[model samples]
Target: MLSRTADHLFWMSRYMERAENLARLMDVTYQMSLVPQSEEKANQSWNAIITLNSLEDAFAAKYPVVNGENVLKFMVCDSDNFSSIYSCLRLARENAHAVRGTLTTEMWETINYTWLEARGRSFDQLMAGGIADYFEWVKTRSHLSRGVTVGTLLQDEAYHFIRLGTLLERADNTARILDVKYHGLDHGGEEGATDFYQWGALLRSVSAFEVYRKAYRDVITPERVAELLILRGDMPRSLLFCMNGVVKNLDLVANSLSGETARLAGLLRAQLRYGRIDDILEHGLHEWLTDFMDRIYLIGDGISRDFLVPMVEAA
Candidate 1:
């Protein structure tokens, strides 16, 4: 396959997955904001979203405050914010269009229609219509797009690249959400009602709340939640699950030049596979997750260098 086609397919899926994850993040943060708390605590919750995406500078430039209203507008529809849901859907559609012939009709229509609907709604309209509803709409549209792609698109190299993009993006976002929220919450001391609610919100953010209950059949705790999201292979959105998918897809699409990239992905997967949550917490979850994110970035760079567009070294 041409590297150009591969690039577009890879990013189209990535952007779509990113948009859905952003909706999940915003929804959870929005829910947490509704909980009764001090003004400072509420502000901290909203600000955590900004920090999670590393959008502190960009968010500050446009919005004077870090409250719910401003952050929602900035994250949901700010055209200049490349990571905003609006921008993600737009970019996904554009990439899909670039390789229009490569995509199935169902796939193209699903993405194009998602962009069309999303582009028509402004932040004000989203707020007026109920932001939670809009967030659900975004998540539903993303699910539809993925379902269509999986059902309609042939399972070939193109399919492998799309799946790769989704898995890698999911892995990065899962780590980001877990690391940021874990630190932001009061986990250094004893667990309380507030901590329980915060931890439950975090689980629901990744649709892991029920899984947590089933796996432990007990009250939510920092350690069990961490284990569920980080180590449980059965948890669909778990880091381990995402890495497993990444390794499988990389193997399917591997070329002679992609051996190193595949090896890097496998190395990460092996670490997660053999990893224990107790050791991760002992070493410091933040430190461990920081290392994981850095490695994820390296794998992304490797993918670009090996399969997509090769990055040129600075002169």
Candidate 2:
């Protein structure tokens, strides 16, 4: 396959997945913000959100305060923020359009319509119980795109690359969300019913609440939640599950000159599969997750080198 086409196919899926995650995060944050808490505590939800998305400085420079409305604007619709939902959908559509020949008609239409719908959503609309609706729309549309691709596309290199991008992006988002929530609670230590609900809400944001219940059958706690999101293989959004997909898909995508990417994925997969959440916590979860994210970035570099379009140096 041509590197340019591969790049477009891979990134289009990734940006779609990223947009869904951002919506999920924003929905959970907005919901938590509405809970009856002290003024100071309600603001913590927005603060944690900024930190989670790594938008503290950029967000502060654009907005004077860390409130629900401003953060939602910066995350969901800010034209300047490339990681925002609007930008993700716009960029995703542009990429998908570039590879329109490679995609099914259903796949193309779903992405196009999603982007068009997203552009019409205003900040006020999202804030007034509209964010939740938009969240459902983003997730449903992304899932539809994936389903169409799976049902229509051929089993070839293009399909494998799409899987690679989707799983890799998902793994990073799941890990980062868990890391941010864990650290936020550790520092804030607002224990009680409110804290319990916040913890469960984090699980629900990733669509993991039921998985947590089935796996543990106990009340929600930070440590058990970490276990569910990090190590449980059956939890579809768990780090291990997503990394396993990367390993399996990369193996199929590997060619004579490009086995390195598969090897890296396999190594990461093994580490997580054989590893334990208790061990990670004892060693400091933040340190462990930081290392994991660094390794993920390296694997992303490997993927680009192996398959994506390369940049040429100026003479």
Candidate 3:
């Protein structure tokens, strides 16, 4: 396959995964808002969602009102915001559309339907009925698309590229969610057992709540949360899990460890495997996560260099 084709397939899946995660994050925040928290706490929830997406300025310009309703509208329906759900699904479909022949019919149909559904709705239309149901629908569709991509696509270069993209995006989002939890806690004071609820909510935001509960048997400490998200190799969305998947895909693409792709993946995977959770906590969790994210970003660049972009001279 051409490097360009690989790049597109990888990015197509990445964008779709990103849209789903953002939708899930916003959904959790919106649901929490409906509970009886102080006005200040509710606003913080909205603010955190905006911050997580790194869309403060765009969000500010459109939703100067900045309440739960307006924030949801701006994030979910507004196409002007580049990371909005509508924009992401549209971009995902467009990328897939360009390579229709390379993908299965189900892959194209899943993403195309997602694009249509998102494009056809107005913010008011969503807000009028069940808000949670709407966000859940978006997430469900995104999940379905990913399932179709994995189940239907052949295990060739196309599938590897898409898998790489999805894993990379998941790694970054997992890192960001960890950082957000630490920051939110440091700034927002503890509310007794409410911290447990909040911590559980954080897990729920990443859809890790049930996994976590099963693993620890109702024990939800901050440290355990950090470990589960960052160090657990079995959890699909964990950083370790993502890194492992990415390395496997990178190896499959480049076909050998001599290339830059192999070297980059090996380096990052080694770091994840060797690093201890206690060490991360002893030194500093936030700084550790920040460094980990930076390395992942570097790995992404390296992958693009070796696989997505040609290394040959421009004759």
Candidate 4:
């Protein structure tokens, strides 16, 4: 495959996955904002989303405050924010269009229609229609796109690249979400109602609440939630699960020049596979997640160097 085509295929799926995850983050943050809390605590919840995406500077430049209204507008519909849902969907469609011939009819149509619907949504329009409902629509559209791709596309290099992009993006977002929420909560001696609600909200954001219940058959705790999301291979959105998929897909699409990228992915997967929640917490979850994100960045850079267009050419 041409490097340009590979690049488009890879980022096309990544942007789509990113849009879905952003919706998840915003939806949960929105829900948390509705919970009764001090004004400062509510703002902190909203600000956590900004911090999770490392958009502090960008967010501050455009919005004077970090409250729900401003944050929602910035995250959901701001055209200038590259990582906003609107921008992600637009870029996903643009990339899909670049490689339209390589995609199945269903996949192209799914992506194109999603963009068409989401193209010009204003914050007021989104709020009028119901914020949570709009987010649910984004998630549903992403799910449909993935479902169609899996069902219609051939299981070839193109498919593997798409899967790789999705898994890597998912893993990165999962780690960020967990790290931000875990640290944001009060870690004092006992769990309170607020902590329980916040933790439960975090689980629901990742679609892991029910999985947590089934696996532990007990009340939600920081340790069990961490264990479920980080170590449980069966949890589809778990870090381990995402890394397992990443390693598998990287293997499928591996070339002679891609050995190092594959090795990085494999190493990360092995660590998660053999990892324990106790050790991760002992070492400090924030520090551990920081390292994980750094490694993920390296693996992404390796993938680009090995298989995708070079930085200069892409520029």
Give Cα-based local distance difference scores for all models.
Answer: 0.89, 0.84, 0.80, 0.89
Model 4 reaches what TM-score against the true structure? 0.97
Candidate 2, which segments miss by more than 4 Å at Cα?
A: 311-315
> Please, what are the lDDT tens digits per residue for candidate 2 over residues 40-82?
7667767876886677888878999987778778888998998
Residue-wise lDDT of candidate 4 within 125-209, one digit each (tens)? 8899899999999999999999999999999899989998999999888888787676565355225897788789889988898
TM-score, per-candidate, Cα-based = 0.95, 0.93, 0.90, 0.97
Q: Tell me the alpha-carbon RMSD of every candidate.
A: 2.0, 2.1, 3.1, 1.4
Off by over 4 Å in 3: 255-258, 309-315
User: lDDT by residue for model 1 over 1-315, one digit each (tens)?
Assistant: 998899899999999999999998888888877777788877887888888788999998988988988989898999999999999999999999999999999999999999999999978898899999998898899999999999999999999999999999999888888876776654553257877887898898888888898899999888898999899999999999999999998888788898888888999999999999999999999889889989988998888888886666311
lDDT preference between candidates 2 and 3, better one: 2
How does residue 258 of candidate 1 score in lDDT?
84
User: Which model, 2 or 4, shows the larger TM-score?
Assistant: 4
Clashing pairs in 2: none
| Candidate 3 local lDDT, 189-295, one digit each (tens) | 57666677778777987889999988989678898999898888998889889999988887777754337757777787887788888888888887887788788
Clashing pairs in 4: none
